[model samples]
Target: MQITKCLHTALLVADLARAEHFYGTVLDLPKAERPLNFLGAWYQVEDYQIHLIVAESVPADLVNSEKLGRNRHLAFSVTDLAAAKDQLLVHGCSIQMSASGRPALFTQDPDGNVIELGETQLA
Candidate 1:
């Protein structure tokens, strides 16, 4: 069987309100109408969607602690890397520039979910 495309990525969040603020308010992702009768929120990014599922606890385990971008992350393309970094900082989000000298930066959500932003286009 051949794969077509990725429909969405579900992330477990401990606090729904904080997650919604980060993804919705901070990141400015459009909220998508979800029909599931559960505690969660959905954000639409281009053709893809991010599903935030509420959980009792979300582990902040990172395989590579030195580099946050090396861990599990959701990457997105931005028009300006500098402006993106500035916005994240203004919202009190800690960010890490790509160690590989790429035009990208990595940050974490309230639940410690890694998010990568770059000026380059994503395939």
Candidate 2:
């Protein structure tokens, strides 16, 4: 059988409030209605969704410390890379520019979950 599109990405967060601030406020992702009876928050981005599940502890192991972009990360396209970088800095989020010299950057949430933001053209 053929595989279907990705429904969502689930991330385990130690602190739900902090994770909400990062994904909901900082990144400006719209909150989605979570019907499940669990400690978590959901954010909607276009057709995709980000599910933040509350956990006792979050894993902070980085496979590639020097180049976070090379590790396991979720990537999203942005209109302006510079503005995105500025926004992340203003929120006190650390960032790492793509080593490949592309218009993109890697940053981590409060739980140390890597997220890549890349520039894309508006069609």
Per-model lDDT: 0.93, 0.95
lDDT of 1 by residue, 1-123 (tens): 999999999999999999999999899999999999999999998889999999998998889967998899999999889989999999999999999998999999998889999897556
Please give, for residues 13-51, the per-residue lDDT of candidate 2 as tens digits. 999999999999899999999999989999999989999
Model 2 ranges off by over 4 Å: none
Cα lDDT, model 2, residue 37: 97
Worst 10 residues of 1 by lDDT: 114-123
> Where is the poorest 10-residue window by lDDT in model 2?
57-66
Model 1 misses residue 65 by how many Å? 2.1
The parts of candidate 1 lying over 4 Å away from their true place are 121-123
RMSD list, candidates in order: 1.8, 0.8
Give the TM-scores of the predictions, in the order they appear: 0.95, 0.97
- TM-score, candidate number 2: 0.97
